[model samples]
Target: MKRALLLLIFAMPASLSLAACAAAQQTQAPSLAKRPIEGRFDVAPPAIVIPPPGPLPSDLAGRLARWEADAASGQQAFAAERDATAALVAAAAGAPVASERWVVAQQAISRLTAARAPLSGALADIDRLYIERTVDEAVDGLPDIYALRDRIAEMESAQDAILQALSAALPGQ
Candidate 1:
């Protein structure tokens, strides 16, 4: 019984010392990294931003300057490109049916001409919008509101036809 008491007395101090050590470690626990960005194990850098389109042709500066002018300018660009393309076709050797190509070119010219007045009408709408700040207000008792609407429609249709013809003319599939 005396020997057992002595063994327990020795073991008690060692056990207490171990408990104190564990408690100290718990108190001094290291803090976690607050932000995930600090340790970016798998992250890459940000991508570049591209600007909105600018004038394509050097002379196209005037066209892009004012927003309302865009349609009229676009029409001019279409005609110019069509003429240049037609000239190329006329000059090209053994291009099947140059006469047919020229006829198509005339049709494009007619379409562009037809598109011009409507485009001008759209510009008028823009001008009205500019003056009045709202299309609702601008459209009140307007002399030719229908004509302005017609022009916007014409511009859309003409733009589509131009694209379609160009797509057809582009070099083989």
Candidate 2:
């Protein structure tokens, strides 16, 4: 009887350890098979290939050319105003109270603000043109419009940021 009791004590731990190993194996078996099942059903779709877009119509191209010219001139005008304002501010700092240079600085700033109006208008026209073109292409079931549309949006955002910065940097708020 004592021999049997001694055998039971040692065998019980071995049997428990064996059962634990089997349970671990059963859980891990599903994970090992899961990868193959997932791979079989999770096939990726084929890549889409978009064709190149055609050139803009002559009239639209002309409009874009004119707007580009306007944008260039507007940049030149803004730079001129910025240089004049800087000079006037420097002069006003050394001059006596209530200097005329300060007034000229204000005028330069006003001119800068005025110059942005036509630029903003030209940008809007460009945006409208691109949007219309994009929509037209979409109706025809084409994907090439995205590039032009994105370009226009990027340009509009950059120009708008410049105008905002100029407005903020103007002397006296």
Candidate 3:
């Protein structure tokens, strides 16, 4: 037992030391592949710039009791719409969503397109200064909805191009 204990106690430290050295050497080696982007669920609350205390729309009064709450809800809704569109990009060749998801996304986009029409002036340093009512008003320059309209135009153009190419490839062409 004495001999065994002497070997075990002394040899154990040497064995452990070798294992530690091996681990350190392994860690020093360069990785063969790029690391993936980390999935972060830590969503920071969005900072909202609320429109001023203009005359509240009669219909909106009930939905927007407190200015902060109304702003938060609007922001949250917009965020959901934005994320859905991002997913639609990965949902295959077509829109990434389907059924109710597609419908809701389309509706949100439509509502957002309308919402931006009256945002004529360049964005103010502080969004709270704008009259919330005016956001729905039709301003100049393609009516503040150029972005959404442009997207539609691009989609139409792409479809037309595809059709044209197909026609050219046909046997009768």
Candidate 4:
């Protein structure tokens, strides 16, 4: 009797589920042919027209000038530091790791690394301006911005080469 009751309980749900599925299958979905048409699908979307960019603002132009000047100064300072660091590295090349000369050379290398900050900052600012103008669809100052960025990048690359040479010259590096 208990077995029959268990079978009945299980069969009841199974039967109900089967019946529900059958009923669902028997119900017909509304035909697409019978539905009313909406808007016309044949026409193409309108073209978007972007206006040409005008002249750069005076303040922005001044900022670019200042950045360029700062980059040039930084490059000069970097060149001086690189030369000094190279001399120190050469002097320390044969010195003991714990020697004062070696320590001073390491400090000079650190200073050389620090000198790159201005160039990097200028590059970052130029990149930000480029992105902002690009996003705003403004193309006026992009040429100048790009030229400055390239110049800064070249300066940075030259600085990096000097630093690498000096670092490689140092003992125990």
Ranking by TM-score, best first? 4, 2, 1, 3
Q: After superposition, how far is residue 63 of candidate 3 from its true place, in Å?
A: 12
How would you encode candidate 2's per-residue C-alpha lDDT over 25-77 as one tens digit per residue? Answer: 87845434456556786878888987655555555556666777666676566
Q: For every candidate structure, what is the RMSD over all alpha carbons to the true structure, in angstroms?
A: 16.0, 6.8, 22.4, 5.8
Cα-based RMSD of candidate 3: 22.4
Tens-digit lDDT string for candidate 4 (55-159): 776768998997898888888778778878888888999998869999999999999888878887887888898899899977887777888889988988888
- Candidate 1 local distance difference test against the native: 0.54
The digit string of per-residue lDDT tens for model 3 on 57-107 reads 454444323433333344444444444443432332243345554555455
Full-model lDDT, candidate 3: 0.43
TM-score of each: 0.30, 0.51, 0.21, 0.65
TM-score of 4: 0.65
lDDT of 1 at 53: 33
lDDT of 1 by residue, 36-135 (tens): 7777766686888865333243332233245346566656765666665555434432335446654555455455555455455556655554455244
Better structure of 3 and 4 per lDDT: 4
Error of 3 at 90 (Å): 4.5
Residue pairs in steric clash, candidate 1?
none
